[model samples]
Target: MTNPKISLILSAYNEEKFIKKAIESVINQTLKDIEIIIVNDGSTDDTLNIINSYGNSDSRIKVINQENIGLGASRNKGMKIASGEYITFLDGDDWFATDAFEISYKEAKSKNTDITMYQMINYDDESGRVYENDWFNLNNLDESFDNIVFSPEKTKNFLFDLSVSSCQKIYRNSFLKSINASFPEGIYFEDMPFFFHVYLKAKRISIIRKHLYYRRKHDASITHVVDANYLDTVEAGCELMRRFIDNGFYEDYKFDLIAYKINGPRMALMDIREDAKKPLFKLIKEDYEKIKKTKYYQDYLDNLGPKKKKFFLDILKYDNYTEFKKNNPEY
Candidate 1:
């Protein structure tokens, strides 16, 4: 049998409410040469049954039933069995635009790139409002060319900018296999590190300035939940930073690395659980202190704007973020 043009891997864990719509989106894609690989990570709800219902109707729908192994492992499992020339990810709770695969695949082929990055629509479940993901707005670089290949330095900056989400991007199957890029199993925030590895190894990357995916946000989503699991961000950040230094890209990418470290804790302080906040903040603070001693971070701080410098000062001042916020309400 001939391989499909694109393989869409959907990782689900009790996402029964949105699984049907997610499946239908792939099945109805404008590009018919696609396969939908749904990994039911031991869903206790009717998610598996829903997947079965669709698998029966569409020959392209492949379902894998396995024990609850979390998103990272489930995605790895799907990738191992994928038979498509290009690969992409879609959360079971989210769906894609009908022409998503068609457009991305065409761009990847025409550009002969190892990866193709695109924008997404962030849909708020409660508010019923849709907005473009901020990553696109923040990237001031021009992307009007038919094929603008990212330079090596730009690739490092892209990874550091936290534009490392696995979704809303299409990757060449050969490039992924060659690099052996896979997510960290049994961990939260797995995309960041994997994204760094992929972009660093990729020789050619293309960007599209259009929204082709929908990222649904709600209270139940992992991103919105406030818990100890959020500490995984610190763990991932530290590990990736050390790896960057060890790999000898630290000298060139240190500015970005330091910026990432500083911004991470600032964002974490905003949403982490009240009880776990202080401990996580301490860890982030200690890591920052160590990173700041490096020449790269010191240089970055030398040129930092007054507003940002003040922000960093406040963040590093108190170990207890709760008390800090109370004392300085502006933060």
Candidate 2:
């Protein structure tokens, strides 16, 4: 067969229950000339069997079976063998809208962008709820830290507040290869660091406000089942911070990004409505000290007004951030 224009890579682990639906979503895509690379990460379940069923019928579907390497490694493996000009990633449990690839491909071609990101909707199966789509409005482009635009400084600032999810974006294969980009192996937040690097390298990017991806909430998913391993995600964020600093990207946006990472886990723990009082306080104190010792710390702290400075100091003092939730219940 001829080489495909796009390669859809899916890193799956024990997704037998939803794998078929995910595959069907891709098989039914409105766009043609695409190949599906399904990397089976040694699922003990019948995920491989489901993939074989599709592979048997469709020449475009290729399956790679390997030992239970993590998602990052699986994606890297798939990319190595992909023959497409463009690349897109999907989780095994997530489904895409029929027109997702079609629309994205057309827009990317028209704009000659290296990356294209669109809106996504979160689907909660257990709660029977579908959250409204979260989109990036490019109409009033700030060209600053706030609005999503294509500048190194603005991109760095945006990473402080939000890290791009792989599922939401499509990347040009040539650009990815030129940057030697691959997901960091054995990392929990595999998408964030790599996404940041790509955003920094991208010359042109397109943001489509239409919701075209369905991010399903499953019980067995990693985010739902938190354990000690979840700490790896926090460490991954730290690694990204260190990388940014070493590369001098942190000079302008050090404080904001550090604050975001330092408080990220604490905020997550708070959202679960569980008491993380002691550990949270300990982590806050440790991070605060680390920040204080950094060269940029004092200047960043000085730039913060009275209220914000007190807030960081209070995080070190308080056992838990539950008090903030109490005052601002909506948060």
Candidate 3:
């Protein structure tokens, strides 16, 4: 199908159980003019077999198999071979709303958007509690507008608040290729850097004021796991900030970048193992030391109150998470 309306890139690893649900969600969509590209990233389970079965039955489904190269690389492969006007990624463990395509694509085409953003629902498997994330709410403009569209530069204040997950946004294929936009390889926090790449290149952005994606949160999810790979958070933050500086956008978004770097990793750090606390804390302080050398660090650092500033400094003294948790008030 030449120039399919949308290309859905599905990346799967060992997600046999969830992959079926994810694929069905796409198949069940109201918009059927789409090509589903499923990348079976070296699945050591029945994932590949399941993917192949679907491809055999559906002429629109395309399957690619390769050794485990991580999520970012897998998505990059799909994007390379994509033959669609618009592209969006769907994790093997996640699903899209029935009208995600019809709704988002219509607005994207009408606005000529380089990037189309939408809200997401976080599904917690253990407790069966599902909640909507307002990161893509666009509340400030909702009262005056329905489908908000503009250059991200015009609303720089919303830059940091934008959703970093690829599943929450759709991109114009030609626009992404023109800017050479792709996910960062060899890192666990690839989403952060890739989102920054879009943030840097996107000019005309539009939004769907509805939840169009469902992200599963469970013990098996990578975000909930803690290991050496967790160290990639610091590196991802640095890469994102470095890109902003390289593109000459850092000075304008310095404070937000710095604050996100320090705070963004905190949620994952809270689940760090006892053995990794000291080493991880050491790196965190070292990361701050690197931040201090930046030209705008002092400008923003000075703006912080004495107590808030002390909290940053105080974190350096502790070698253990417990000691820090007991005495230090800062996260």
What TM-scores do the predictions have? Answer: 0.84, 0.80, 0.88
Off by over 4 Å in 3: 136-141, 225-228, 266-271, 289-300, 303-308, 311-331
**Can you rank all candidates by TM-score, best first?**
3, 1, 2
Pull out the clashing pairs in model 1.
none
lDDT of each: 0.80, 0.75, 0.80
| Superposed Cα deviation of residue 116, candidate 1 (Å) | 0.5
Model 3 residue pairs with clashes:
none
- TM-score of decoy 1: 0.84
lDDT of 1 by residue, 1-331 (tens): 8899999999999998988888988999999998889999999999999999999999998999999999999999999988999999999899889999999999999989898988888889999999874674336345543358764556443556546679968999988998787888888888887787777778888888778888889888988887778877777777677667765766777666756755665577667777887777677667667756876566657745665566566656766667667766643
Per-residue lDDT for 1-331 in model 3, tens only? 3689899999999999899989999988899999899999999999999999899999999999999999989999999999889999999988999999999889899999998888888888889898865664545445444556777676677677766888888899999899788888878889888888786788888777788888888778887778767877877887887787777877778767766776655644665665665676777777776666767568547554565465456565665557777785443
lDDT agreement of model 2 with the native? 0.75
Higher-TM-score candidate of 1 and 3: 3
lDDT of 2 by residue, 1-331 (tens): 6678789999899999899989999999999889999999999999999999999999899999999989989999998988887899999999999999998888777777798877778889799688863332332323332223354544453455442688888888889998888888887778777877777778887677777888888787777765544556556766667766765666666667656565556555445334444444455556666777878577646655564566566655555556654653543
Per-residue error for 315 in candidate 2, Å, reads 8.7
State which candidate has the highest TM-score. 3
- Model 2 regions lying over 4 Å from their true place: 133-159, 269-331
Window of ten residues with lowest summed lDDT in model 3: 136-145
Question: Compared to the true structure, candidate 2 yields what TM-score?
Answer: 0.80
For candidate 1, which ten residues in a row score worst on lDDT?
Answer: 137-146
